[model samples]
Target: MNWQQAQKDFEHFLLIERGLAKNSVQNYSLDISKLINHLSTNEIRVSPTKITGEILQHFIYEVAKILNARSQSRIISGLKSFFNYLIFEGYRDDNPMELIESPKTGRKLPDTLSLNEIDDLIAAVDLSTNEGERNRAIIETLYGCGLRVSEVIDLNISDLYFQEGFIKITGKGDKERFVPIGEITQNYITQYLENSRNRVSVKKLASDVVFLNRRGNKLTRAMIFTIVKNLALTANLNKNISPHTFRHSFATHLLENGADLRAIQQMLGHESITTTEIYMHVDKSHLREVIKDFHPRSNY
Candidate 1:
């Protein structure tokens, strides 16, 4: 197939078969188009089916020179997925990215806020206005539940179970899990809903959505980021903070306070225990205390 036809087919597969959104499909196509452009610039005349491992390796090498390690890693991963799709569709016999190794980058541990820092951020909110109270509630929920930003925005009134003390979170791939909500967070949400949200003229479609913008539409992920960034600045927090920082802090604090790792794993919706183990690295004092309290020779 010609490049144009192959591109069209790939786009259709991404949209119809994979069920990816328009922007996501566009990003995948853009990654492939970059490779196509590279081949053209190098005077190589190989179609998607005929692309060899050596050519792919050279393309990655050239890309590495131009992009940072993280960007290069992302591009490589995107290309691998694209080529894997081509192989799955029987358009290619072998995957050129089979031997492509991602760059060796150290795992940067996620940033976390101390309880004081979290308090500072929440206190920075001006609760004089309706939107201000809603924003405070949004921040409280994010830090309290350790929710992903998307999960926070998509939260519905029906998902909250304050009496049962659980909030059902729908995560990636539409997977659902129930997380325990604290009384403080519950009270904050209750205040927002009863006092702030109740006064708003919410849009019909967004009536059930827990957090709404000034326009009464569901909050966007970018808006959440902007909210957190502004709050951090207002509170004079020097550390680079994001919504995910609260999630890290939540996990870390729980682990430090003698909460079981397995229970944390379940609450955080981590499929693997190893993913939850990262929190174990954050607090060495907790480990020392555990050994002192439980070790057989401690009394000696």
Candidate 2:
């Protein structure tokens, strides 16, 4: 099959069969696109079904010059998945990437804001404007609930179960999970809904959406990143931060405070405990505390 057709088919498979998010599917397609670009640039004519391991290895070598080990690893993984899909569809007999190995880039820890820094970031919001309460509530929900940027932006009014102390989150791949909402977060959201959001001229399409622009349309993912970026600048924080910093902080703080890792995993909507275990590596002090408190050799 042609590269273009193969890439299109792979995208459809990822979205329909794998149930991947649109953003995820696009990322997967990008890997194939990169390979196609490489072949065209080098004047090498090869179909998806006929592309050999040598061609892929050369392409990877070229990719390494432009990308870091971690990024290179992701591209390799994405390519592997694409070829696996091709094989599944009976387009190819043997997998070419079966022998390819990703670079040994050590696990990179996610950046997190300390509690005081989080407070400072929230306090930096301009409260005089109409969007002040809304911004405040947005930050509160993000940090308090440990929500992904997409999840917070797509949060719906109907999903708020205040009395039940939970918010329904539609996570990656449209998986739904109920995450407990703290009283502090609930109150901030309530205030925003009652004051800031009620005053907006909301669009009919975004009526159910909790977060919105002044035009009352649903906030885009870019807006969320901008909000966090501006807040970081205003707070005069030297470290680079984003909406996900709040999420990382949430899990790290919960782990530091002796919360059960499994419970944190549930609240964070992580499918695997292994995914949630990264927080364990964030705070060595907590681990020391555990050892001192429970280990039999602590007295020695």
Candidate 3:
């Protein structure tokens, strides 16, 4: 098969068989496209099935000259997955990336917003406008539920079980989890819906969507980033912040407040406790306290 056909089929496999989210599929596709670009620019003729480890090494070497260790490692990892998929589909017998090694990039900690900083950012919104109320709800839900930005955008009115004090979130890989919603978050969302959302002329089939742009369509991920960036500027905050920052803060605050690590994992919809363990490094005191309260030898 041709390169384009191979790319398309791989994406289909990732989406259907692997159950990866759209963004993940796109990232994988992008990695393949980079290889295609490398081959084209060098006037080298090769097919995906015919590409050897040597050629991939050459491409990665070229990539390393321009990309950081983190980026190079990511592309290498992506290409490894791509070739593995080909092997799984009977397109090849051996894995090309088996001998390849990824760079040792140490654990990158997530940035978090302090509670006062979060409040200031929320206060920066222009409340006179209808969009302000919607933005407030957006920020609150993000921080309160520890939701990924995508989760917040794809949220629907039907997903909210306000009475039950929980909201259903469709996370990465289309996995669904019900996260508890606090009274503050529920109240802000309800206020937005009653005062602001009721006025929107929502587009067809977007009626059930909880967040809408000024054009009455579901908000895009870029829009969420812009909202956060603009708010950061207005608040005069020196730190880089994003919707994910709220999620990190949510987890951090919960840990600092003596919430269980497993409970925080459940609230964040993380599939693995290891993923949630990163927060443990953010507060050494919490770790010490855990040992203090639970370790049998600590009683002495």
The Cα local distance difference test for each model comes to 0.88, 0.92, 0.92
For residues 146-237, write the lDDT of model 3, one tens digit per residue: 99999999999999999999999999999999999999999999999998998989999788999999888999999999999999998999
What lDDT score is found at residue 247 in candidate 2?
97
Model 2 — TM-score against the truth?
0.95
The lDDT, on a scale of 0 to 1, for candidate 3 is 0.92
lDDT tens digits by residue: candidate 2, 122-159: 89999899988999999999999999999998999999
Comparing candidate 1 with candidate 3, which one achieves the higher TM-score? 3
Candidate 1: which stretches are off by over 4 Å? 1-46
Clashing pairs in model 2, backbone N/Cα/C closer than 3 A: none
| RMSD, one per candidate, in order | 3.0, 1.5, 1.5
Ranking by lDDT: 2, 3, 1
| Model 1 TM | 0.87
Question: Which portions of model 2 miss their true places by more than 4 Å?
Answer: 295-297
Alpha carbon lDDT of residue 176, candidate 2? Answer: 97
Q: Estimate TM-scores for all models.
A: 0.87, 0.95, 0.95
Error of 3 at 203 (Å): 0.2
Clashing pairs in 1: none
